[model samples]
Target: MPTEYHDLSNWDIGFAALLIIVNGVISVALKLGLEKKLIVASIRTITQLSLLGFILEWIFQQNNWFYLFLIILFMTLTAGYTSSKNATRFYSGMWINSIFAVMVSSWLVTSIALLTVIRPETWKENPAQFVIPLLGMILGNTLNGISLGINYLNESLINNRGRVEMLLTLGATRWEAARDSVQSAVKSGMIPILNTMSVVGLVSLPGMMTGQILAGVPPLSAVKYQIVIMFLIASGTALGTIIAVVLGYRKLFNSDHQFLYERIQKR
Candidate 1:
């Protein structure tokens, strides 16, 4: 194992942060698009990271189960917020769906991966410090997939109402009629992830691997962790997206198996 490198304290974080402001200014002067977005993003990132840094320090000190539960609750809320942002009004109760999907898929995959794969004797020792980041990334990626599935399902059911009606007329079940649509939506949503898999090492180094290496974990172990996380992400993405798609389909269809195109409304 490599020795811990805590050299960043000597470096001026403020000076590095100033570069972001400079870039935003340059963007405005050059008429580049999204200057406002860049400014907002920089501010939000700073604020959130700062707050989370303090929370993490406190969490490390306490190391209590209640704090762990709070972390999970916050993750759920964040996943739901992201899902709700892109979700249609037609998909009522989508927050509930998002929470359930992220929680179930993340925990299922993480538990299995930990127990059967890593098998750390004391699982709870650094769960908040370690597992939470992995779960957050998984929840975030899964939310992206769920957004795609929900949007695609809504548009398809709206555009192909005639087909849906015809299926209903022919006694086809709601699930049967919309199965292909949901599947396609899921595939489309997951395409970026598939592409990421192909370029994981060649194009980019993931955060888990980078952080582990920086914190003195062996390169081989970091690589393994990265690979496991990517697989777990894929698993959670599929599960969460499927859940959203299925629940959204149920919401789109009614007792008579008819398409509810009229129900979708802009909020």
Candidate 2:
């Protein structure tokens, strides 16, 4: 049998961190004034991932579906809250819409893929190990799309107010007046995923495939999993972006079909 992949020692890991020092150097030379932000980000990255490692280890040892579902709920809530930060303060309802959108898209796509394509028999045995990580992947991608869509939609409404108001004055329906902005917002959110799809293999190796290879999985097997995940991520992101943008734009108008500019949160 092939030997299992070796683990990294702390000393070896520290050597890998030299790149961060290089980043700090660049920041200083460029006068970017981002040393504090960089340091905080690096620290947060280590702390969060270290904690997640322990959490996943414990979850993997449990057979209780309730705990698994609770993790999913926490993930969905946190994703929604984080994404909502990108929205204008006026749109308090964005959190509800974002949560719903991310949950529906990510859960649907991730569950279907897990049950259908991946089909690890381990799921029926200890599902948390398989489901939680996969759900995280789906939610993470969907969160980005939702946040970007909300940000774009909010900005578009503000910047294109004149055009939208003129359309309404000319007897255009609310939907018609806002169709362009909604479409633009959705497109903005989907662009990153689209670009990744276009250049995935050519530009860079994706995280899952690279990590699996490092962990001693066969490259071809890792590639197949990566392909399936890319499909899930793309579909989930598109669905979430469309749903969030549609719901978000509605909140910008009232029952009279009049724009609610007053609802816009002041910067």
Candidate 3:
């Protein structure tokens, strides 16, 4: 933030575009069709982030608690929408469940970090700098993990409906019948975070702590902050993915244990 103001520095812009193309090229070279994903991703990202940039500028000016609440609400809403688009194999009109899961789970993690842990002395001082970004990170990760979890959850549930039916006939509750698949999906989603934690120090430092260190925050302080973020993400992902599947289970079947699959509007 050197008085020159570096919202999107030239270096960042160059690297971002370069990375996008390189990703696409590498994928196509390896027969992964990373090219198409990169192309579509570029347009979608540019349009969405442009709109968000304007909204955030205004949001920062209105830094009241309710405003913060509204901003989080908006993020939840958008993420829910896209996540649902990707989750059509499991449900329709599912933004509600995702919202519910993200609300309770991410907020619990974020609140513990901001209020109980960091205990920032004043909101106005760091609203844009720390809190918003951290909240965004938590919410974004929760959305991805939970949606990915439920996508696989639905597939497993449909495939193993016979097991579920058998369990139900044996008097298992609705929740119990689906517990195994739900647990499996949640575990799958959480493995990424667990794997990252296993190699955090030896393999690669995370951007949050690394950036902080580059900016001159003491190594110990940066490490502590990064640890808090990692823990919060792990906790948030676990809670979000679990709750999403629990709530999402309702969408997967009729009272007779039938599946409800649908298509999305194509984001």
Candidate 4:
């Protein structure tokens, strides 16, 4: 098979943009009041992706470890902030906990994959290609997991406040009182990735594999890459969800086995 694929021209992209008009038309016809949001989202997607393309191109050329590190740090910080902000409820120092969870989980998984699975020849000198994309993918999924976990945990605790307090009053430890909520939150966070994994090839071809195939990669090779990506996402999501929930649990419950319900606040 040829290792080359046709490059997309500006006209091709412009034509593709026309597909958004279908969404706009639907919004107008249904009176969904989503036209403005659709326009804004479309504009942001084009602008952000374009900017990222240029920045990634430059970074790829530079091959400097420092620049790569800065980019990774910036991406991780942004992911953390976004994750925390997506939660409908708030708690004291939740942002810090979210950031810590996302950073630790995504970074750990990405590092292991890079070091062991996709070890490049110039890994120490330049690992931008593998690190950037893998970390970004992991962080993106992990962010969702963290946000979902936090939201679910908050809602569960608030809704089951009486039950939890009753358990606590019955000599239950804080962990015992909040165990159900924590487990449920973690499960909720992991649901998306789990569902995706369950129906990946049957329902749809994931973007990574599709892109690789479009770029002329052998089908089996693309499938392998996608498999690795799915595992990485799953690992990152699970780790991040567990860590964020545990941290939130600790924050909501004191060492003295008391539930500090007051610490949780509405956003």
lDDT of 4 by residue, 1-267 (tens): 747877899899888878888889999999998989999998999899999999999999999989999999999999999999967788989999999999999999998898788775646666787899899999999999999999999999999999999999999999999999999999999999999999999999999999988998899999999999999999999999999999999999999998889988998
Alpha-carbon shift of residue 199 in model 4 (angstroms): 0.4
Instruction: Evaluate all candidate structures by whole-model CA lDDT and list the values in order.
Output: 0.78, 0.86, 0.76, 0.93
- Candidate 3, residue 230: the lDDT equals 86
1-267 in candidate 2: lDDT tens per residue? 334788989798688677888888999999998877888988898899989988888888877888889999999889977887756543767789899999999999988987788786747888887888788888998999999998888888888899999999999888888889899999999998999999998999999888988888888888998999899999999999999998887888866888886666744
Looking at model 4, the pairs that clash are: none
The lowest-lDDT stretch of 10 consecutive residues in candidate 2 is: 85-94
lDDT of 1 by residue, 62-122 (tens): 8887888888788867886687576555456766876777778777887787777767665
TM-score of each: 0.89, 0.90, 0.75, 0.94
The clash tally of candidate 3 reads 0
Q: Candidate order by lDDT, highest to lowest?
A: 4, 2, 1, 3
The residue-level lDDT of candidate 1 at 83 comes to 73
Q: List the residue pairs that clash in candidate 1.
A: none
- Candidate 3 lands at a TM-score of 0.75
